[model samples]
Target: MSATRPTLKLTHSGALQALDGALRKAEELGVPQNITVVDEGGNLLAYVRMDGAKLLSRETSMSKAITASSHRQPTSRLDPRNEIKLAIAGGGRLTNLEGGLPIIIDGHCVGAIGVGSGTGEQDVEVARAGLAAIGAEDQKP
Candidate 1:
């Protein structure tokens, strides 16, 4: 057998610092939000919910991360398009909701960040901070 070196599929791995970065953004934005980080496989890596954050944000954050990680698409893609329904109906993992973004590096998808409790726009901004903090590319729209 030929020897092969192990390589990581996702360039950016989830980190607790990412969660902190997101929380900092939430504080800066004057909003409390629940944030989640997940690996390429949609497995939770780190999570944090600020005080006064909406309770529903917990599930939103988790689902967002899962959608971004598994679908390699931003949660915004969960637009009521039929594609989203298929993704959910096929038993494919994805939050199909807004406020989630995929972490990328060198044009490669690494992981994902999910933010909730704030407006969709604010959630994107907060999630961007987390990705940037962890050295992940944030070329989100």
Candidate 2:
């Protein structure tokens, strides 16, 4: 067998840049946000809960990242009804709240980012800033 199969993955350096960018945006919006990053397989890669961010948002942020990375779509597109089904059906946990985004590069999904602890719109804005940091915003589906 071959030593390995070709696949796209997010680098820690890239994740850090994204995180920094998101945090900066959150500061601009006066929001202390929780941010999460996950691999395409929905595995947690990086995360941060900014000072003053709600402790409850930690799980939600990870859930959003998992939902987006595994489903290859933003959590905003997930309907309420399907949320239950997706979880029960072993599709993995999901959240309907916005701010979750898939990270795409060169036409392939590398991972995802999720932001919480703010209004849905503010979360999304911060998440987009993260994507922009790695030049992945325009690549998103």
Candidate 3:
């Protein structure tokens, strides 16, 4: 077997499915938001921001998703235990509030999705739902 390099890549179908799920759920939750998907290597896969989403949420969502994948942990977990420089908590550092969720499949983390502009809990919910939309919960890096 050859050594495998970690990476994050988005597929057209997967992106559309995640976007659709997140958009629908977010509208139902009544929050205009920015949703981001990044692969395990902290690479951008897909990004969508509904009208009225704060400009800050765009970068924030991306950071959260990327962080989740890079660290193979939820943004919330990293937010508290400051072991990685990318871990954000106070002013600056992606907020680390919540919403970033890891995309795990086959016992491996392949990517992550982040939802912004709603409560932290809502962000996490919608992000999880989005991953479920495409059956990405078991994806691996």
Candidate 4:
């Protein structure tokens, strides 16, 4: 094996694009939201707390993004049996909420988007909009 391999990454611009898309969807749904974007390594790239969004949900949005990036999948798909355990193990960084979605492109997870301050289904819908803005693959039902 080679000592190095090429890797796909989500650029800052892309992260902002995702954020914008999520924002638009939230507006259309008439639900304010706290949105976050994180790289594949779970590093925050972009974030926004929409006006009137729940202030407490800002933290949850970041947690969701980090969880999705770390797990390389939608946060909603995480094992529910391990929800509490995972949270404790992750020191609250990981969550099983339905607002986190991985940004997958060319079979690689580039990053993730997380949204909060709405119903779980609405949050997921916003996250999906973000993924779509960047041409990332949506999670299967």
After superposition, candidate 4 runs with Cα above 4 Å error: none
- CA lDDT of each candidate? 0.80, 0.85, 0.75, 0.93
> In model 4, how large is the Cα lDDT of residue 16?
96
Residue lDDT tens for model 3, 1-141:
769977545576677788789888888888888999877676777889999988888877987787777667677775445544444232344445688888777667877887887878888878877888877762222
- TM-score ranking, best first: 4, 2, 1, 3
Q: What are the per-residue Cα lDDT tens digits for candidate 4 across 48-130?
A: 99999999999999999999999998898888999999999999899998899999999999989989999999999999999
Q: Model 3: residues >4 Å from true position, as ranges?
A: 1-10, 79-95, 138-141
Full ranking by lDDT: 4, 2, 1, 3
Per-residue lDDT tens digits for candidate 1, residues 1-141, read 769954455433346878888989899999999998888788777888899999988988988888887777787775576766756674755566678888886777767889999988999999999988878877665
Question: Regarding TM-score, does 3 or 4 come out ahead?
Answer: 4
- After TM-score superposition, the amount by which residue 50's alpha carbon in candidate 4 deviates from its true location, in angstroms, is 0.4
Clashes of each: 1, 0, 8, 0
For 13-127, candidate 2 gives per-residue lDDT tens digits of 8888889989999999999999998888888778999999999899888888888887778888877778788777755567777889999888788999999999898888999
Compute the lDDT of residue 87 as modeled in candidate 1: 68
Best prediction by TM-score? 4
The lDDT leader among the candidates is 4
- The superposed Cα distance between candidate 3 and the true structure at residue 67, in angstroms, equals 0.8
TM-score for all predictions? 0.83, 0.89, 0.80, 0.97
